[model samples]
Target: MRIVVVGGGMAGTIFANNLARRLSSELKAGKARITMLSASDKHIYQPGWLYVALGRMTPDELEREEASLLEPEIAFFVDPVQSFRLGESHVVTRSGKVHEYDLLVIATGSRPVPEDVPGLKENSVHCYSAEDALKLHDRLQAFTGGRILVTVGLPHKCPMIPLEITFTMHDFIRDRGLIDKTEFYYTYPIGRAHSLENVATWASGEFAKLGVRQETFFNLKEVDGAKGCVRSEEGSEVKYDLLVAVPPHRGEAVIEENKLGPNGWIPTDRYSLHMQGDHGEKVIVLGDTTNLPISKAGSTAHFEAEVAAENAAAMVKTGRAARSYDGKVFCFIEAGKDRATYAMFTYQKPPEPRAPNAAMHAFKMAYNQLYWASVRGLM
Candidate 1:
């Protein structure tokens, strides 16, 4: 049996490593094979970007060679897929090579589309990518004082980032002794401060204590950079000296070009993690590539990858799937520089975040270093 995994982000890497371990006996007997193909040779810890924006971590600290984290039994390639020929059970790469597989796992992640909003790309600084984080770091460093605005768009990766960034930046500015001189303004697209009700409630109280102004139902429409103000789709306008935005997101372009799902997201079974169509049995979708209504956090990808890997390995060895994904996700929320909290929930339950503590913050910091081990399937 041949299993091909696409995209080397957290989801793909974890799935490949887990499956290789499960099929070790079959691999030694020449009965099964696991191969991973990715666009880049470097695997980055994406969550660390928030810390990068705050000057807590350097970009080099978050990077590792993709092959270094994989098991020796798994084959690795740096060729990116250009087109998906699911009808023929094959994929064409940018190098004009065709690869066939018995089981295909698509974990291609999402992309931030800041340009989707008029003038937002030109005026905002975001930490979605390494370069963007570095740019934000520089901008924050040079900032003296004034209003700092945080604007959020819907369906972004790491649902807690909008709140996390705001809280961390408040601490950052306070450390610089500019907290009093700077006014903090935040906007969300929903009726509340966050998509999750409990998180929103927690964030609202925290904002009140910090004296941060907030506006809800403020969908992004346009930014007038010259006037230093942003307009909302609902005809609301807000001014800012520095704009920090969590832009809207979409799945990879290959998925969109292949028409796998609208906006590059593949229609996937929420429970089985399989593609939702005739060939669904042979095609599994994980991570940001799946059109599941869940938080697009690294933990979401981590849990889904576990289920996909287990089911695929079971099918290869015993001719049947073994388990189903339960929509489990765990995320650490940095309430401030020295304190943190966490949210753990499943499909049937909502997250109940506890009060912030230094111990949880320390654990979150430790987990940052342990992420490499986690990706290698050693956790």
Candidate 2:
């Protein structure tokens, strides 16, 4: 049997690695093969990039070669996927190479769609992608002090990241003695400060203490780069000196063209991570590309990979039913002045039901080290 895993992000890498390790015996027997496809040769630790933008971490610390993370035995395809033919049991690469597989796992992840909003692509600086974060970091370093606007475009990855950016900027400016000159504004389309009501209340309080203005329920409509202004769908306008925006997210076109999810995301059972397609039995999906109600964050991807690996291994062994994936997510919310908070939750259950404290911050820091160690097999 041959398994093809697409988009080697956190979820894909972990799932592929886990499956390969568990099926090593089968692999050695020439009974199974595993392949990993990635668009880039480098594997980026996305969560660390956020800290890199804030100057707390360096870019080099967040990136690792794709080969370093994968098992040496798994086949690696460094090319963009052009399309997926579910019925044909094959995937066509951008170079026109077709790969046949008995089982396929889609962890293609999500991309920032700045063009989804009018004028955003041409006007704003998006900080979600690694490239965007680097650009934003340069811009932030040159900025003296002005009305800085941080806004969430819509349906972004790591939902609380923008808020962390805002808080971190506040601390950065305050440390520079430019607090009075810097006017920080945070805007979101969500009705509340954060997604969860309990967390929103705590976040609003944090913003208040940090003297950051909050704007909620304001959908970003267009950006006026020349005037440094952002317009909302309700016709309200927000003027800023520097705009840090999170772009709308969408799944890869191949997944969309195949009628995966309503919004280009792959629809899957919350528990099983099985992609609902014509060849549903042979296809599974996880991470930001899925239509799961959970927050689109790295932790969710990591957690989902655990289940996907078990299910894939089971399918190869006894042909047993796949286990369901419970929605689990953990997030670190930056408070101001070297302080931070963290939260963890599951489906329909709120994250800790409150704001995180210093202990949570310590946990957050430890988690980063622990995660990297796990990836390196040192943990």
Candidate 3:
């Protein structure tokens, strides 16, 4: 059986590694093969970008060679897929190489599209990319005082980052003795501060305690850079000295170009993790590429990858799927520089976040390093 995994982000890496382990015997016997295709040779720890913006981590510390993370049994390539011909059970890469597979895993991940909001790209500082994170770092260092507005867009990766960055920024400024001079203004599109009711409630209280002002029902309409203010879809205008935004996200461009699904998100079965519709059986969708109503987070992808890998391996061994994804998601919320909390939830249960503590923060810090092992399917 040929298993072709597309996109070498967290989802793709973990899934390929796990599948390789499960099919080890078959692989040795030449009965099964696992292949991974990625755009870059470097595997990035994306969560570290948030820390990079705060000068807590460096870009070099967040990246490793992609090939080193995969198992030797799994074939790895740096060529990115340009198009997916699901009907033909194959994908064509930028190098014009076509890979045919009996089973396909789509984990292409998501991209932040700040340009979707008019003037947002030019007017705000974001940590979605390495360059942007460093830019934010410089902006944070030179910032002395004034309004620091944090705006959030929908369907972003890492659901806790908006809150995490806000909390951490407060601590960062406070350490610099600029807390008194800075006013934090946070805005969310929904009626609440977060999508999860319990999380929103917890974060609202935290924000209030930190003296951060919040505006709900606020959507990004446009930014008036000259006036140094942002307009909301709800007809509200707010000014800022520094704008930190968590821009909206969409699945990878390859997914969009192939017309797999709207906005680059493939319609996927929430439980089965399979692509919805006729090609469902052969194609499994994982991570940010899936149109599941869950956080586009590493934990979400990690959980989905486990299920997809297991099911795929089981299908090859037993001619049937062995499991279903229960929408399990876990995230560590950095309450401040030294304290953190975590939220763990499944489809049937909502996450009730605990109070922030130093131990949780330490664990999160440790996980940052251990992520390498985790992606290797060792944990």
Candidate 4:
């Protein structure tokens, strides 16, 4: 059996590592093969981008060479995938290299579509990538005082990121004694300002306490970067001195070009994570590639990857169905400099995510240090 994994982000790399380890005996016996195709050598710790934007961490600290983390036992390719021949279960690389596979795992994360909205590309400083985070870090570092606007576009990865940025900006400004000089503004298209209803209720109060005014159902439509103003689809408008927003998200061209989802995202069985192509060929997607209607945070990716890996391995080894993910997700929210909060839940709803505190902050700091080891299954 040949299993090919695409996109070497957290989901792809870790799933490949764990899957290969679980099938060690078959691997040694030459009964199965595992191969990973990564676009570049750089493997970034994505969640750390938030800390980067906060000026608490640097971009260099969040990146690692993807090849460095993959077990030597798995075949590695430094090939960027162009698209898939779904019917024949094959992938074509950018350089026209064709590879066939019995099972495919796609972990291609989403991309921010600033182009999706007119004038958006010229307006906000997005903190989704390493460079973007570093840019935001510099902007935040140099900012003296004024209204800081943070808005969230739809279908963003790490849905908690803008929230973390909003809260962290408050602390950042406060540390410089500019908190009083600056007013923080936030807006979301969602009704409660967050995905989980109850959590939104609690967080809204926290935002109020911190003097961060929030608006719901305000979908970004146009940006007037010159005037530091934004107009929402609902006709609401906000003006600020600095604008930071997560643009609308869409899946990469690999799936999008193939007519995968309603809007470039590949739709999968919510429980199984298996995507059925037009020819009835199925591929398992573990991360942002799928339109799962859940938070596209790293935690969701981690859990989905584990579940998908188990199922893929079983399908190859024993023709058995694996366990369901049950929509389990975990998230840590940093409310300020020394404190943070956490939430853990399943499909239906979440617990009241922990209130911000020093312990949670310390926990996050420790996790950052141990992330590589954890993903490599060494800790």
Candidate 5:
């Protein structure tokens, strides 16, 4: 059986690795083949990028060679997916190569849709991708003072990232002895500081203590690049010397073109990770591309991979129902100044108690090391 995994981000990589290792015997016997398709050779440790942006870690520390993470027998394709033809059970790459598979896994991840907002595509500097993180880092290093506006676009990935950047900038500026010269403003489209109510309450107190101004219900309408300001739907404007924006996110184009969902995301049985459209148990999806209620985070992807791998293996062996996925999400909200907070929850409940301290910061650091080692098959 041939298995083609699309989009080699955290979810794809973890799913492929788990599936390959579990079915190694079948793979060696020529009964199973696993292939991973990605658009870039680099597999960035995205969670680490937040620390890198804060100068806590270097760019080298946040990057890993994608080849090192895959099993030796698995094939790797470094190319963009042009589209997916579900009826034909094949995927066409940007270079016109067609891949046929008995089982398909969609983990292509999401991309920043800066074009969703007028002027944002042309002006704002996004902080979601590796390139954007590096650009923001450079911009931060050179910034001496002035208004620094960190705005959150609609349906952004990693909701806490913009908040973290805001806090980190406050601390960075203070460390540079420019606190008095700089003013920090955080704008979010939501009515609260974060999607999670508990997180918003905790964050509001922290922002108050740190003197970071917060504005809510200020959906970003446009970025006045020429005027160096961001205008909200309410017609209010905030000027800035450096604007770190989080653009709206969307599913991969391949999934979009195939009529996966109205929003381009594939609807899946949350616990099983099975694509809703497939009558058989052949197609599965994970990560940001799914309309999962949980936060689109690295940890969520990791957990989803576990469920998908198990279900995929079971489907191959017996015609049994797949297990359900509980919407459990965990996040480390960086509060800057060598401090952070931990929050976790399931879909029905609110965020759990906040674990605030420097130890949480240390835990975040160690988690990255563990992630790298595990993905490289060293653990």
Candidate 6:
């Protein structure tokens, strides 16, 4: 049997590594073949972008070579996927190579597209990527006693990242003796600061206490960098000296290019995390590719990887039903340079901080170290 895994991002790498180990005996016996495809050999630890922006960690700490993380028997390909020929059970790469597979796992993650929103491309430096985070770091370093706005575009990844920026700036500016002069403003599009009601209440209260004005129902409409301002759908305007904007995100172009998805996202089952198509257990999808309402976070992808692997294995072995994902998501956001708040929940329930303390902060710090181990299938 031949299997092809596309994209070397979180879900793809985790699934591929685990699957390779699972089928290790088969690989040695010439009963199974697994090939991993990535757009680049660089596998970036995405969550580290936040730390990089805050100057807590360097970019070098989060990057790894894709080939180093996989089993020796697995074939690795460094080529961009042009399209997925689902009906033919093959994937075509940019180099005009075709990879046929008995099973295909899709995990090419989403990217922030500030250009999608008018004027945003000119005004925003985001924490969504290493390059973007480094740009933000430079902007923050030069800032001296001016209004800073941490705002979001709709449905962006990591709902808590913008909030983290709001708090991080408080610490960074305070340390530089500029907190008294620099003002903080954070805006959320909907009626609350976050999706979970309890989490929102706690965060908004904290924002108020920190002098970070939190505004709700202020969906971003446009931005003007030269003007140093942003306009919202609610007819509200906020001026800023610098903007850390969480731009809108969309699934990778390959999803839309193959017509395997609508709006650049593959329609997926909420519970099973399977691609909604007639592929008959041949195609499985997870992470940013799915249309689930959960936060598009590393933790969500971490958990979803397990669900997808178990289901894919069951489908392969017994042609049985796929297992269900409870949508359990855990996130720890840095409330301050030293303090953090954590939440855990599923689709039906909202998350509440069990104990938003320093211990959880320690866990998150350790998790970053373990994250690399996870990529190597050590966990």
Worst 10 residues of 6 by lDDT: 312-321
lDDT of 4 by residue, 1-379 (tens): 8888998988998799888888898899998899898888888898888888877789899888887898877888989788788788899988899989888888888888888888888878988888988888788888888888888788788777767788888888898889888999989887876776766887799888898999889998899877779999999989988889888888886677767776777878888788854643457888888887788888888888888888878877788867988998888877676888888888876567756789989999999979998677554
- Candidate with better lDDT, 5 vs 6: 6
Compose the digit string of candidate 3's lDDT tens values, residues 1-379.
Answer: 9999999999999999999999999999999999999999999999999999999999999999999999999999999999888889999999999999999999999999999999999999999999999999999999999999999887799998888889999988999999999999999989998887888998899899889999999999999999999999999999999999999998888888888999999999999998998777889999999999988899999999998889988999999999889999999989895999999999899888888899999999999999999999999
TM-score of 4: 0.95
> Residue by residue across 68-124, what tens digits does model 5's lDDT show?
889887899898678777778888898999999888888888878898888887776
Q: TM-score of every model?
A: 0.99, 0.94, 0.99, 0.95, 0.92, 0.96
Residue pairs clashing, model 6: none
lDDT winner, 1 or 5? 1
Give me the overall lDDT of model 1: 0.94
lDDT of 1 by residue, 227-261 (tens): 99999999999999999999999999989988899
Who is ahead in TM-score, 2 or 6? 6
Stretches off by above 4 angstroms in model 5 are 278-281, 376-379
lDDT of the structure predicted as candidate 3: 0.93
Q: Tell me the deviation in Å of residue 204 in model 6.
A: 1.4
Better of 3 and 6 by lDDT: 3
Deviation in Å, model 1, residue 9 alpha carbon? 0.5
Backbone atom clashes (below 3 Å) for every candidate:
0, 3, 0, 2, 3, 0
What's the CA error at residue 254 for candidate 4, in Å? Answer: 2.2
Question: Residues 320-350, candidate 6, lDDT per residue (tens digit)?
Answer: 7567989988888877757777888898777
Which is the better candidate, 2 or 4, if ranked by lDDT? 4
